[model samples]
Target: MAITGTSSFSVNSSPVFRRDVTSASGNLKRNLDLKRFAVSSEQATTSSTTTKKFVENGRMWKKSGEESETARRVNVEESERNGKSLKDYFDEAKDLIRSDAAPPRWFSPLESGSHTRDSPLLLFLPGIDGVGLGLTTQHQRLGQIFEIWCLHIPVEDRTSFADLVKLVERTVRLENHRLPNRPIYLVGESLGACIALAVAAHVPDVDLVLILANPATSFSKSQLQPLIPILKLLPDQIPFSLPYILRLLEGDPLRMAADNLVKGLAPEPTFGKLSHDLLTMSSYLSVVADILPKETFLWKLELFRLASAYANSRLHAVKAETLILSSGRDQLLPSQEEGEKLRLALPKCQTRRFDDSGHFLFLEDGVDLVTVIKGAGFYRRGKYIDYVSDYMPPTPSEFKKIHESNRLIYLATGPVLLSTLEDGKIVRGLAGIPSEGPVLFVSYHMLLGLELYPLVTQFMIESNILLRGIAHPMAFKRLKDGKLPELSTFDTFRMMGAVPVSAANFYKLLSSKSHVLLYPGGMREVLHRKGEEYKLFWPEQSEFVRMAARFGAKIIPFGAVGEDDIAELVFDYNDQMKIPYFKSIIEEATNGVINVRTDASGEVANQQMHWPYFVPKVPGRFYYHFGKPIETEGRKHELRDREKSHELYLQVKSEVEKSLAYLKKKRERDPYRKMLPRLVYQATNGFTSEVPTFEP
Candidate 1:
């Protein structure tokens, strides 16, 4: 019978084979060939020449001088006993098949020089014609790495559907009995795949069930329509049609086996077997030049039924590990969507499809088959991604990869100048700030304390900088009412590595990575009793002298200029008369008064603690400048040579004054400038100017 189609190539038509004009065998080889079936003469000769490949009989016939006759006989007897045991096992296997208790017997490759067992037992179930010589030498070679078991079902030309199912059940039971404790896997092709699935359902021991080119539905009355016209014709008209049907009967040893034949076809070149099977319901198997889906209404109907059945069946919920390979180019069964639906139904199963391959994915992409099988235990497809859109846990490996790929970043709030620029474009010192030393943060304490939060959060979280602040004892201690203020929580400051140093421990803090953010002006600058605000108080000279001698670390004189202009203090401190006991305790703790003179020689000794002062400028803006670090490490402890340290400290203060002047000018041109017009009106309305004690 001749099958003329693009799928079947004529080797003789090529230049390499033009010179060979051969006989029937040669003609068959040249015109149509399963090329892998051809074996070399040398290999055939070598195989034929070998009677027993191993020295199995050597122990029975050993050297005479090596041992006594009785001992030699005992060893020979033991060897023969082992051989008999192997023969007995094979006999039992064959008997099991004859009695319909098991499928066909499979031979495992012996462990020898070339035959190494790497993979486990992989049982293959064939459709129709049980086992054929179509398998190539390469297939056998692969067996050296993995044990191959080919299953043969008990369905002949006349078997019914019920009988086929019984055969499958018996075969599964036999397999379980034979490999009682061992794990075995299944890979089924075409109708054979259907039988395997059935067997797998009955056998809980089966590790995996691989279905290849399986139909979407059973090929019974409706799908057999394509063969109807040809069946009406006699054997002489199309002799091969009846034989093909007989072959399909062999496939029916299990339910739905015959159905696999109808759904396997797809138009893609790689899926040629399936495509060819659908086109010609004749003896020949080859691709048709043109395909017409309209000609096979029965095939389509059967497929739709099969797909629906599989979807509705309990088999979809089978616990056996499954991997479904869909054909992207499948012309049969609406491959992509069907595969997707199947995957969704079987959420735990893995699904993969090839755009280049079709229904016969195993044949065209067998190399990938090895990989998929090896990875089956770990494979999980259609995994949900948790991206605020879904509920899935983030993978640790993915998190690590993202973390490694991201660059380290540091962000600071309020672009402030650290040093003057050569071109006069303020060189922002955020990135350039030295991370290693003791940094005393001297800044203006803005009213309402709103500016400090961003500064603190950014310093600790965004920038790698530790902070220490010399807060007032009043700020750190719990309120007299037994409740802690929100800002005074130790937990908040501890997370940021902030240490609130008392006046006694101020030196330790200033010596560490202690960035002491302090406002020397304190409450004196903050108080704008009746008519004064936005002005710096006449700072006590002792406040500057005491801070300098306390730490050998650099004194970073800084300021925060804007805030007081927002609200003027309209009331006096006496308005909220303190409880006498609380007032007495505070006064006792602070020494003579709440605020007292630190030095008698300094100009600030003349300033009274209750006096208040105010700024004459418009209440529009304020600024703070961070002067260079003052080197107080070399200074002595004596109050006599405090003159030199005082002179250097005054330089830092002058630099701060210069920065404040620059900021005032900057405020004039700055687009973000705003004024609290109400504070301006109150300041103009003769608000009182009074001072309260601030013990920072």
Candidate 2:
């Protein structure tokens, strides 16, 4: 006969079956009789009809009350036998533990009045035969001070591990739709810990993960070999149920009842009889073990293999904040040192040790356990998106999109220097000077101008800042206004995070948090005389003094050393006025036009290889040394003091010259200087050149 909610049993017949009890000690009457009975005939008939409605109607309270009535019996007996207070037993045990065995203690529960639902959602997982009942009561005391959610793990293969994950995804989606958005936390015990880690790997949104008494390191086929066969065809002899089959298959009914009780108390738990409740938990585990598969030896072996793999597996990499809680005094798992080893492997994770508690710390620590888990910042649903492959900005298409959207304009507003040391060598670079004040940065411009790459690389990687600059009219014409179709917003490259400001809003843009780039040298820097390779050519009409004075910003002068040495900057200012041949050449070269005459001397200027290149000095290494920050605030009205601003600008210019000379000397004997050809074309501005090979 099938039995549900087994209530009370005679202590004379069963030493193992124990109940968790509640009592009104020092009251008028102490004698209260306990009895076990199945649901009445009429009640049984109504159960099926009521089950769905009851669950849907928030009848968790009813379910827990019923379960608790059954679970409390053993505890009542323990209190009577011990006579002393339950707290005294725990306190005594706590004091006697060896120093080496002490595990970390759970955090004390915050006062109920101090709790808020704004806390993140935390999911709890129980070990083998772990029903969440008892823990739920403890959690309730905790939930009063923190919001928490507990879920039941299916023992039966509702689906394979892969399919199971999909199921969880669906559940999460459903829950998100049902509730407000929030982050979620996950805490798993033993086997559940493995599942939790697996879920974290797949679900990037998980905030923190708590593991309890996991046996991953020591669990192998040998440990599970005896039980594998029955697992393959679970509930063996189901249709042909017999007495013998039942006897061998029965598990701890009381413990199972206790698990149900814990789950019922979700969001809050009663922890007065915590120790007695824990002792009774072992019975439920025993029952769960019996019903698990154990038929044929081969099938059992397969089950064991699968279990071992699942337990041992780990996420390849995790980026979310995480916490690992392990018990040094655990009976099932090895020493907490095993957890330490796992922590070492996951260098990014935070960990806490509990020496006093065993595998079931949730019971031992009770309300404190809830406090610790809740503090890690758990979320339930709707707070964050599921792990999307496009979240990282490194994805190629995403990166492309962001670049297109951000429109980083390299502005050159000064005399540009270009040079070369030999034939077939091109050398070119830029020096940027910024005006002090939190004003927008506007420098020079280059496209397919070779020097553009080095300038951008220096600003991004070396300076570690997202730079924005104003594009020349010609540069904008080629860009076509960043209107590329077939781009995804999910892609990081779409530059959704960047803003494309115009010259009309230049002042407003300068007032923002962007580092503006401008090239005042314009086309004048590209046109060089035959033998004058390294020369600064400035435009007659430049906006430097006007912009610095208007914004009251300091002028930070930076020099581009090798830019003039690369290739002759080929362009015609009147191309827009219907100049056919020159316009076509400009168009071709601007769009990566090649085969044009290369500046032999300009090539030598690129030899100073740095990161991305991994190569040492080739021709010359570009250096961007930031001088002291200039203070130019409140000078906006001092427009007539042009020479005063110019003097400060020259000081910046002098500093740039000093830094350039220092970089050149430092790279003179670097190994990359030996690999001439590989340093340029193959490495693209020598950004990612391979390190030069050396002869031993």
Candidate 3:
């Protein structure tokens, strides 16, 4: 077929293809042309290659081919001697393919350069497309650590969903037999994900861990079900066009075409020239075009049927531990609901939602998916481990580095004044903090959360305790491009033993008897707008109070003030929202991930609001005060009562507010609070300036 600028597949020729292609814009047609050109070029190169033939010992021999008949007979004898028959070799090949008549194929590893016997077997099942080539990016990265096996179903294999399940079962059984002791991970994306879950359910004895990405189990019930009738009407020999299908799939066509064009011209495309999504989609389309034939009507129908057939009933039989990676922006299925349903049905299940991704989340966000997989302990050595004890405590070297950074910050931002209650009286310099126990420091997050450096480092210096900070979920999440933002605070947060804020993580930390830091105000307090400094945007519910009571933990309410002095807010929420692009970006970032600020007047209305614009001012001193530890040891019974628990929650909020008010009032008394005075004192006394403290 000639590569054409416009897709030759007539919209009216096949009703199914027509309905599907109705969404395809002119951009999609151009993309298809590019893909076809690439394929045609590859075919041309292959066809041009000549095979050398020669006669060796009265037998025909090819220079670029295998050994002669005598050599083959000797090899056969050697194989038979080793208890191997032709059927054994045939069966081995069949394991990778559907049948004996099928073309010979082998599982392609993620990495082709190296082979490690100890690597875990990761079987990847493709989505409805059945191309099995969309995960090239994943394969490239994961193959380095895993024995990646992507199943390539033949285009002509029109097996029913049940038979497909059997095929997967057989493959898994063979792999299990080959590596009896080693762990096997079955990874499925979209349609393949549903198949993987079904296979897991059928083969109860086969020890397998499932990693499902945007499973299509809910597709039949989703908004896409309306398209099934149209798909069924498609002709048997409907023309295949990658761009047309991608556009129908709601993928960005123009960008994909542009990216493919760049790749075709340049072996290595420059990063940042094209958006990551465009590049990923382009690569996916290229693979799909290469593997799938033009007439995909039957395959499409089969996929739809399979999606409809695999209901929640089958999911109940899945005994293996499953990790569902749901995409919030999934165009093909109801990923979030499907994931939740699957989680409920499975005995052991964990769900993670990628809010920024679509149906091709695995292809677009491969690195982040890998990180989550590793974190979940899905790909471990030998047997599967239930829990991943991967939390790294702050090392001595990290402590030293943090201490040095803290000192520098203190010098730059002015002396950090620390105060706490001692014997019902105000005391200075961190004397009130307890030396041990499950201490939970509930603090108001300062603007940009800069207070963390002084608070955590000073406590470490004084008490020799590394505080495990409960941070925002954003701190642990990778960006939309499957890579961590350069110079992001995430690295710092992780190195300092900061875990993403979750009830489970909190409980784990408390149960382990570790010092934990929590900010009930969360992102709202840190990214507060102008005139909102030191304001507590704490939630009304007192869930943490009950949790603290359960662990009998010491809850110390603390607060900090200095953000107003350091910088002036130039743009508030209203100002930022006025910019259409900025507002859209914010919406995109938080869409389906978390609820954004909705109320305008409520205390927690703007709690989800972030992105405050600020300009630096004269450097100012930071002040912190930790209230008397509220011992929940004997208050476990009171926590059971909602009223009492809420009262306790209010009390903590009040204490944090009180600490902020006290700091604001008393900071005026500090001699070093003003820059000129401290500068003169420093100039006169060098490093030995005796700054006067406030009197109680």
Query: How many clashes in each structure?
Result: 11, 125, 1
True-structure RMSD, every candidate? 29.1, 23.3, 19.8
lDDT (Cα) of model 1: 0.38
Higher-scoring candidate on lDDT, 1 or 3: 3
Model 2 lDDT on a 0 to 1 scale = 0.36
TM-score of 1: 0.31
What's the distance in Å from true for residue 513, model 3? 1.8
lDDT of each: 0.38, 0.36, 0.60
- Model 3 root-mean-square deviation: 19.8
Candidate 1 segments whose C-alpha is farther than 4 A from its true place: 1-425, 429-432, 448-450, 482-503, 527-534, 543-552, 572-624, 633-640, 674-696
Which lDDT tens digits does candidate 3 get at residues 1-696?
Answer: 322123332222211111111112211122232321112233244432334232222122335433322121112112112232212222222232233223212235212212244667777787765645445544434543466656655555565677667666776777687668877788888778878888888888877889988887776666556655665666645544465445434334344445556668552342343344345445565344534454454466557566557735587688887888887767667788888887767777767776655676654522344446644435554664311133423334444654675666766566454556657677766677776658888878888887887776666665566677887656644233222222233555665567766677878777766678888777777877778888888876775899889888888888788877788888877686889977775665554233333433456545443467789877777778888899999888878899999999999999989988988998888777766677777788785554555664
Instruction: Summing lDDT over every window of 10 consecutive residues in candidate 1, give the lowest-scoring window.
Output: 385-394
Sort by lDDT, top down from the best: 3, 1, 2
Candidate 2's displacement at residue 519, Å, is 50
lDDT per residue for candidate 2 within 1-696, as digits (tens), equals: 233333222111221112211111211111234321222344345433331101111011112122221110111111122222223323322222212121111111111111233444455544443232224334434343234433333233222344433434344444344343555555666555555655656665544444444434444523344444544555554522122222211122234346647678532233434435444333334333332323322332343345447545655554444556666555445536656655655534545566555555554532244324322222122344211111111112322333344432221211123222224132332223232223333332222233444454344433333343443233212222122221122122112112222344345434442354444433433333233333333332234555555655554444444433233433323422256754454444444312121232342122111111012122323323333334456666564466665665555445545545543454454444233443444367554433432121
